[model samples]
Target: MARLVYQPQSPLNATLAVSKRWATSLGIWGVGAGTAALFLLSVTPLVKREFLVKVPVVGSYYEDKTPASDKPF
Candidate 1:
């Protein structure tokens, strides 16, 4: 007769197979990705303008306007 082994069902049971150094590297990567996402979200207008200016046919006509006109009239 063979004995059955009991496996833990907690989340901690799932462990990354990589080394500790690689785990730290993953943290760094996560931080970098979060920072980049935040930066992109913060500068959405600038990113949109850049994308608009990169279009093949409409790029040449795109212009950046002064911020003064954005106030409520």
Candidate 2:
């Protein structure tokens, strides 16, 4: 009868597997963050400004009756 032998798993192999999983997780998180930033940029305006108004009846007040964005929402 002939003897059979099998090699034991190495620490390097386990380390490599763990590293692969970590890289994949970071990639997914980065993609999600990028997509969220892009959506926010598209839906919201880049510039925002407001000015104060003086009226006899209203006294001093801010101009918030209309939107501050250049384009209409």
Candidate 3:
């Protein structure tokens, strides 16, 4: 008769698999996506003017007043 052998889970594996790395990477990805979206919204006329007009104080910033020199891709 052969006995079944069970292997114990190591703390190292658990620690390595679950860490702040996931959250950190997620935050980085979110910032990158937000930056891309903001750039796209700024470079192109995709965003509707009505939306910017409705926003409170920040409305003026996105109201297509950006100078040619200040524009970025």
Candidate 4:
């Protein structure tokens, strides 16, 4: 029978370089996806509509709070 060659069994060995590379790629991918999600959540139309207000020239035009003519002053 042929003698077996000695090989390293640790996860950090050169034999597992592909797995380590894949892990790094996955980390980068996750970061990119998270950043994209944050950007979309901030700039999406629904988010903008819910958070932002449409002001004409000066500022926001809210409803009047003064008493109406029908009510006593």
lDDT for 8 (candidate 2) = 81
Task: Give the TM-score of each candidate.
Answer: 0.35, 0.34, 0.40, 0.35
- The Cα error of candidate 3 at residue 38, in Å, is 1.8
On lDDT, the candidate that comes out on top is 3
lDDT of 4 by residue, 1-73 (tens): 9999997678667657877779988999999998777557855656445543343552233323457976675
lDDT (tens digit, per residue) of candidate 3 on 5-29: 9988799976777765587888899
- The deviation in Å at residue 36 for candidate 3 is 1.6
Greater lDDT among 3 and 4 belongs to 3
For each candidate, what is the lDDT? 0.67, 0.60, 0.73, 0.63
Cand. 2 TM to true fold: 0.34
In every candidate, how many clashes are there? 0, 0, 0, 0
Off by over 4 Å in 3: 1-20, 46-57, 64-73
Q: On residues 1-73, what C-alpha lDDT tens digit does candidate 1 reach at each position?
A: 9999997765544544445548889899999998788566644668547665686995665555558778565
After TM-score superposition, the amount by which residue 18's alpha carbon in candidate 1 deviates from its true location, in angstroms, is 3.5
Cα-based RMSD of candidate 3: 9.9
